[model samples]
Target: MAELYSKARTKWACRRGMLELDILLEPFVDEAYDQLSEQDKLVFQRLLEVEDPDLFAWFMGHEACPYPELDAMVKFVLDRVRA
Candidate 1:
C-alpha cells in the first residue's frame, strides 16, 4: 500500500507544541516508523491527528485512549520507547 504521508511530512506532524510529545513522537518516527507495517503506519498517522493534550494524557498513563486502534498504536509506541 502507498503511504498516506511521506516520512518527512509525518515527522513534521509528529512535532507537537508540547516538548514531552515532541520527544516521544519525533524519535519514534525517525527510529521505528519505517519498520512498521503499512496498516500500522496508517494507525500511527491517525493517532497523530488526535489533540496534543489527549496524546500527552494517553502517553503519560493519565488517561486511556478511547479508540481501540489508536490505543493500540499508542501502546506500541510507548512500548517501543520503553524497551
Candidate 2:
C-alpha cells in the first residue's frame, strides 16, 4: 500500500519557529523522510505534534526523549545533519 503522508506534506510540517530546529528538520524531511519506514513516518508525525520548545529541548540535547521512537528519529535526523 502507498504511504499516507507525502514529502511535500511532511516538509511543510517541518517548518519551525526556531531556526535551529528548522535547519535540522527541513533537510532531513527533504533528503531522508521518504526513506523512512511507515512506522517511522508515524513516529515522525507524532514528533511534529510535539511543541517547539519540547522539540528544541530534545534536538538541542538539553533534554532526552521519553519515547524511544522519537529518540531514534531524532538521532536519525542528527546523523544526517552531521554528515
Task: List clashing residue pairs in candidate 2.
Answer: none
> Could you say which candidate leads in lDDT?
1
TM-score per model over all chains:
0.93, 0.91
The global C-alpha lDDT for each of the candidates, from Candidate 1 onward, is 0.91, 0.87
lDDT tens per residue, model 2, 12-77: 888988898899999988888878889888888889999999999999999999999899889888
Candidate 2: lDDT over CA atoms? 0.87
| Residue clash pairs of candidate 1 | none
Query: In model 2, how large is the Cα lDDT of residue 68?
Result: 93
How accurate locally is residue 8 in candidate 1, as Cα lDDT from 0 to 100?
Answer: 88
Model 2 has how many clashing residue pairs? 0
